[model samples]
Target chain A: MNKFGIVMLYSILLFSNQIFGQFNALEKGVFSGSFESISQWYQDDNKIIVSVPQDKWATNNYLSLHYTFGKFYAGLQYEAYMPPLLGYSRKFDGSGVAHKFFSYRGDFMEITVGDFYEQFGSGLIFRAYENRQLGIDNALNGVNIRLKPSDFFSLKLVYGKQRKYFEESNGILRGLDGDLDIIKLFKIQKNIGLQIGASLLSHYELYTGADPLFPPTVNSYSGRLDFNSTRLTLSSEYVFKESDPLDLNYFWYKTGNALLLNAAYASNGLAMNLSLRRLENMDSRSERTATDTELMINFLPANTKQHKYSLANIYPYSAQVMGEIGGQYSVFYKIPTGSLLGGKYGTKLNFNYSVYYGLDTTFLGGTQGFESKYFAYGEELYYQDINFELDKKWSKAFKTVLGYMNQRYNKAQVDGGDYPIVNSDIVFFDFLVKFPKNRSIRTEIQHLSTKDDLKSWVAALIELNINPSWTIYAADMYNYGNAGEKVHYYNVGTSFVKNVHRIEISYSRQRESLMCVGGVCRQVPAFKGLTLNISSSF
Target chain B: MKKVRIILLVVSVLIALGNQSEAQTVLPNVMVESITGQEVSAMNFFNDGKPMIISFWATWCKPCILELDAISDEYDEWREETGVILLAVSIDDERSLASVKTLSAGRDWPFTIYLDKNQDLKRALNVVNVPHTFLLNGKGEIVWQHNSYVPGAEQELYEEILKLTENK
Candidate 1:
């Protein structure tokens, strides 16, 4: 066995008791936790042909508990995947305590031992976190310390190994961060604010390869400045990394860097924001061989809107970490209640546009990656989005929303597939009507038009809510524009909720699509199944 | 085979539900960000002198939007009657965080909003779902809590808020 495997075994052996040992008895210290279980039983059909499970029943369950006594806190997590569900990585076949941490906080200093999650400024250079839906947890298993002597400045230092699929990666990571509030240091009590921060992170993996061009250690640093007033705010961060090659980048030994700028202005009835980002071979990972979303050291924030509707989510955008430049601008305006545009109640409108293009570069044959010019926009179009929506309340019991979206996506260029370019248009109409004591109904109809890829699709949904207890929803999606075959994906679900607990059961025929939550995308395979989800905390 | 899977799932769920006696809610001392992106402690706002109503919501959650909108219509009245403040905690990560402010402001929600971009506060508070509401007493003890949102759920929250202040 490898050294990292041995260390992982020891960690599990030492903390198995905390995870398995649960008591109903009362104690001095407060204990709290939450449990979530999502399970599916598949019934395969000729349509939506995909991999059938070796295990007919697949379940993913996570249980977390925490104990707190005064100023000290300790927590542990246990995740069980009786073999993983479809689309989830095979590395998650086993179950164990995935995370554990112990922490202490004093007046001026704090210390944490064992496993923990940390993020530097805007997470441009280093961020270790966990996202359950996306099946990502890169928490560092090591020691972290923080100090603040006199409130003028605060400092943080972290050293550990990134968690790679329930085991430690074969890399050692160390980082330091410091933040200073210029306004606070000067004791300015005005509404304006100013802060500056810097972070430095480095990771070294023992790569005893024969190639001399490969570097064992890669270092990166970032600096940021943020300023804000009551009306306007501006923030900018830049990251620079030393030469490092990885399996994803095809082992190209070139320097990597990223720059991000954000600005926002808010008034009484209007809000506007802008974000710009440029990435140049900035894929940083703890494990050299890690691909897909594993062992990521930094997350490139996708500069685009997160669409919630089904038709809108068909072409969600993920940032191209290798090289790309993109920007997003959005404006939200609230029309006056008595104005002409707004009937009795005020109207809300939002307009957003974002686009990305490849960086102009020429690949230099071998160990060296490529060469690029600054501020050069290439002719290669990666993605484009133009969407707008208007929401209005007609009466105390009636509301309506309308949305229109135009999207252009290059599947071969961006997502690394050999499909042709896809240009799509989507429209959404939503309505909500209220009835007598504690009853409401929501309805949505959406349509998408496209000639390439999945062709065209349409969906309709209706949800009924009875206050304080139950909700029932039914939805259907039909691929009418597909020339080969036509399929109707349908789902019927009901949810029962009580004080701090919820249970849901659904029968769904899901089509293949990318589920994007918070700009992160995960591809869920097509399946026809019965699913159950339950969550509770106490 | 299907029957066996169903039986196993039902058994496990029942075993989990059998231990639901105590329901004490305390804010874990995790740090989150305000709407302006400033770091603040979770325990500070929910434990103020007045009765506090802490609601967990997200930008993309439709049920969360319905719940918050339902409450906003009567928020002024609720606050006037019971000196309670509604603290909306959004569990939007970097992906959808940019929309929280615009959505909330466009809807004219009159509540102090904070961002749980990393979900630190949500994990610590054991909130696995959005639209979860927690009512706290003046002393910062959790008085009542509810999960999910139906149209008339705000009535229960109002009644619980009244009960909390009345008990005090």
Candidate 2:
């Protein structure tokens, strides 16, 4: 046996006979789940969901087993699903368990080998991880080491391969990151603090395709700096990478060199954020391969507000890691108690606006036939948005929020292909009423207007909260414009919960898109049906 | 068309009602082939009654390559002590699978090799990228999983394997 192997074997035996001694009765069991019929009726064909079995099954049904003793943790899972009934996929017909190995020895560090998720410096240059409900898992199949030398400083280093669906890619990925909280480290500068970080990642993969100009290796580097004080805060970060023509392209063209810059500031209840991104053609994947949204060495956090309601999140913005220019500004204020606008309970007002437009082409200068790293190839802004919200409390039992929004989207960029520009105006109002004891009711009304697509829409929602254990929710979204486009979507749901366990049941006729968090994403076709969910952790 | 719709709906409703066995809903099985001419199947790995470690990787993935290189030195010991079976599967696609043999021989990897030529195994695992690993117990059921890699993570895996296989 190899030296490393020998060492590992001894370590296992020593810990086995020493730590656990015996398996706990709670650790043994056969866990399973099944979902034979799932229908997503909003698409053109009924077999849509069947084609992507893993996505459908992971979203619908699966089973996992977990057990732990002392410092050791282990888990296993089996996934099996039938063909999708509606807009789901049929090809996802396999199951495999994901494993995790974690070790925590005092304050030195905690390590996880095999498959693990990590984010460094806001995940600008590299972030590999998962968000199940979003169906996204970009876990690295390798090793991860974290060190916390002191309460004020932390360090992390990771190396491995990116996971593509169920398999690992052939390319290599390695990164090193360090974070130092200056204030805590110094002790005296508690209120006034600073933080700094840097990361370097290299991916080595040989060119396999017909592209002649591509290189066999690529490198990416990122750095961040931040300062925080009781009354003021500022943060700045930058990312850069070596150019590879074959892997970075968006409209069937070679990508160019790239770079990005971001800065933000805040004080009291007021904060402001600004960012300037200039990407020539920066797309990094494990196999140097590109899908709609995979293999990104950097993450673009939407500076714009993240919408919660379905309509607001409908045309959610995706950071253009290729090439784009944009900025954001926001202001917030809280009225003092006992004022007219505050209405004896105080009021809050917030305003935000953001715009994204095409960059000028003059910045990139290339050869006669060769592409430049910077160019404004397309016309029209990818997206633009603005919003304002006001919250007021009339009494201990009553509180409300009113908001307005305006947005513009270029059909060609996000949704793919050119159509027409999208212009929309929206208004919304929500109220929360508390009754005697632990009872509360929340209601929301929203209206949206646009000239293209659906034309106009109206939505209403009502929710009841019985503190400590139960919640009932109901809502409907109605499209009032466009002859046959007028569709009524409604949902009524209830939840029963206690501590770590929760059970939810709902019936609905809904029109919506599926969303994945982290780096995993899949379209969730619309459906009209009943659903049940139960989750518990021990 | 009307008849087809009715049939589909009826079938869906019936299936939903009869699927109480807790066996109908599962992520699809993703198959991968190894350079050694072994057909690595995910179905056989599920809930197999032994602690299993399946590492999804490729020859070109730099981090993955490094991770394997780092673990190879200790893998044998881990197996001897915990009886953990580590399956290293490659998703090199059809065009690149030809080079798998050369690469594995050059690196001298000791674990069992499997090839996922068509990437059928990757999609079933809900993997959007590479270098994902899954851990399973004696029943072939997945217990825990992690994505991405950092240095010194293999030691952590051994820790879990020991805890899992000790009393068995």
Off by over 4 Å in 2: A1-59, A62-92, A149-154, A180-190, A209-213, A245-272, A275-278, A362-379, A512-522, B1-168
Model 2 DockQ (Cα-based): 0.02
Interface RMSD over true interface Cα atoms for each candidate:
5.0, 21.2
Model 2: share of true interface contacts reproduced: 0.01
Q: Estimate, for each residue in A165-261, the C-alpha lDDT of model 2 and write its tens digit.
A: 4556677789898887766677763446677778887777766767565566777777887665533445566677666544345223343443444
TM-score of 2: 0.64
Per-prediction DockQ comes to 0.42, 0.02
Candidate 1: stretches off by over 4 Å: A1-28, B1-22, B46-48
State which candidate has the highest TM-score: 1
Q: For candidate 1, write residues A445-480 as lDDT tens digits.
A: 999999898799999999998765788999999999
